[model samples]
Every structure is written in structure tokens, then in C-alpha cells.
Target: MLGSMAIRALSLSPLDSIAVVVHPDDPLDWLPALGNSAFSASPSAWPSIQVVTCTEASQGMSFSIRCGLKALIDDNPKLDAVVVVLADQPFITTGMIAELIGYLSERPELDYVATATDVGGEGEQNAILMPPAILSRSMFEVLLQLEGDAGARKLFGLPQFRGAALLAADRTTVFDVDTPADMVLATKQILGQTYIREHRF
Candidate 1:
């Protein structure tokens, strides 16, 4: 999943850099493998690619997010914004990423741009506010305040960030793989197979 996500991210023409964050207890040597594979597959993208390791991954998702954001900022201080992409979201495409960046670029007044889905009468919900989303440098402080399992979505509730949020035109791009069933669904979607509904216990 990580490898596929990395390849797709690196393939984007709008992005100048890519960061892959790995947890300390990832079991596999994903960092080196990802680096090697990326270099082998796309030598030009390799230099811009960075593998970040989060020693405090056990601390939760916020730690990993902090680690990756810090690494990207440190690597390129001139960067105007950072796009947070999760490895588990295989369905995310280069076009979606570019769309986020392009939307933010066209609207300098916005602080952040994220993908959202309309949940029927429930109104719209932030699909993930991630990977395919863009966060300006001004929001770094707010992002750093996140902790535990919390994510950037927490900012959505804050008054200061509410009005600045811009939703992407496409909502389906936010789908991600969070469980075995999700992986199956993703595979089925990718292969154009008909979904087989199953009851869960």
C-alpha cells in the first residue's frame, strides 16, 4: 500500500517533493525498500523523495503527522503548503492531488483545501481532509497542536479554520483502506469487479 501510494505521489507533476512517513514499529524495513524502489522506478523523483521515521509513532497519528510535516518544512522552507497523503489511501490519484494544489493556488485567501463528501441529508463531511488536501504554512501551528489519534480534521471545528476550508470538487477521491474489508473493496474497485455484499457479525 505504501509503495503504491509513494509511486502515485511521485508521479505527480505539480508536486516538487514527496515525504513517506514510517512508524518505528512498522515490522518491515519499509523506509529503505520504499526509497530503493522509488529511485529504481523514478530516478528523477528520488531526489525529491524523503523517508521520515517517527520514533513516537506509538504516541499516535498526530506524532507521525508532525514528523512528516516538520521534515518537509525543514527540507524546503520556501514551500507554500504541504499536502498530507496517507499510504492506506490507494484510491487517491495524481489528478486529485494536483486538483487540491491547483485549487489552493488559485485561491490565495483560503488557508486549507480538503476533499468532502455529501452524506445525503446530513450535509457535507470532510472525506479525510488529507493526502489529497492542501494545508498552508499558516496552519502549521494548529496542526502541531494535534495529539493522540487526532488528525487535521480536528481543525474543521475551530472557528478560525472553518471559513477557510475549501472542499474539492470530487468526493470519491477520499476513499481509503482502513481494514481487511476495505482492502477487498479497493481491490474490487481497482479491478472493476462487482462488489459482493456481505453481512458483518
Candidate 2:
């Protein structure tokens, strides 16, 4: 699943590097699996792809975020920003990632660009702000301060952080695979179904 996500991200022309953060429990298993995947099989594959293992993954998502961020920063000290993508979001596409990068690139004032979903209402309902988010170097310190299960979404509420939201290309693009039902829905979406009868509103 993560390998597919990596391939999608790497396919984008705007991205210069990709770091896949794996859990500590099965680092050995994941490393070999990803290396043997189709993306890594090609002789002309990008050399920027790196596999990082989060030693503190058991603590929560923050550990993984820290691991990936540290590796990226160490690899490229001049990195302008990073696109934090979730591997479980199989529906995310290169276009969506390019949109986020484009938004931030065009607006130098904004600290970050995140995806938002409209839940459907008369006024502005609580928007779901999340990844594939682009975070500038200015936000790196704050991001490292995060702990536990808390992620970049928590930073959206901070007044100090100036952020612009991009409407997701579609609901499916942001739909992540967590539960068995979500897996079923993602499978249906992958199969080219536009609507799920059981989930129609």
C-alpha cells in the first residue's frame, strides 16, 4: 500500500525527493518489500528515494513524522518545503500534489497549504484540514514540537500559522483506508465507480 503511494508521489515532476518512513517493528520486512517493488526495479529510477525507519513508531504518528522530516532535512539542507502525504490515501494523485505545491509556490506569504473538504451545509462547516499538506521550512520547528498521535492538522488552528486551503479534487482523493468498510469503499473507487450505493447521501 505504501509502495503504491510512493510511486504516485514520485511520478510527480515537481517533487525532488521522497522519503518513506516505516515502523520500527517490521523495518526489515518493509525495506525489502519496497526495494523489490516495481518502482525500485527500474535501473533508471530516481536516486532521491530513501527509506527511513521510525524507532519510536510505537509512540504514535508524531515519531514517524519526525523521522521523515529529519531525514529530509539532513538530505537537503536547502529544502524549501515538504509535502507530507499519508500512505493510506490510495486515491491521492499527482495532480492534487501539484496543486498544493503550486498554491504555495505562487504565494510566498502563506506558511503552508493544506487540503480541506466541504461536508455540505448552508455555511462553512468544520473543514477537514489535512495532508497531502505542503509545509514550509518556517513550520519545521513547530512540527517537531508535536507529540503523541497529534499531526499537522492540529497546527491549522494556530493563529501564528498562516495557511491556505485547497478544496480536494474529490472526496475520494482525501478518503483514507482505515477500517474494513473504508477499504471496501477505496476498492470500489479504484475500480472506477463514482458513487457507492451504501454511502450515498
Total clashing pairs in model 2: 0
TM-score on alpha carbons, each prediction? 0.77, 0.83
What is each predicted model's overall lDDT from 0 to 1?
A: 0.68, 0.77
Q: Write the per-residue lDDT of candidate 1 for residues 1-201, one digit (tens) a residue.
A: 445554555455477887778776666544455445433345555437766889997778899899988898898887788887767776676677777778888888777887666545344442334455678887889888788988877775576763243454555456778888887877777555222323333
lDDT tens digits by residue: candidate 2, 1-201: 544654555454378888888775663443444444444235255547777888787798888898999999999988889888887887787788888988999999999999888766422256678888999998999888889988888888899989988877578778888899988877776655434544678
Worst 10 residues of 1 by lDDT: 192-201
State the RMSD for candidate 1: 6.2
Model 1 local distance difference test score: 0.68
- Model 2's alpha-carbon lDDT is 0.77
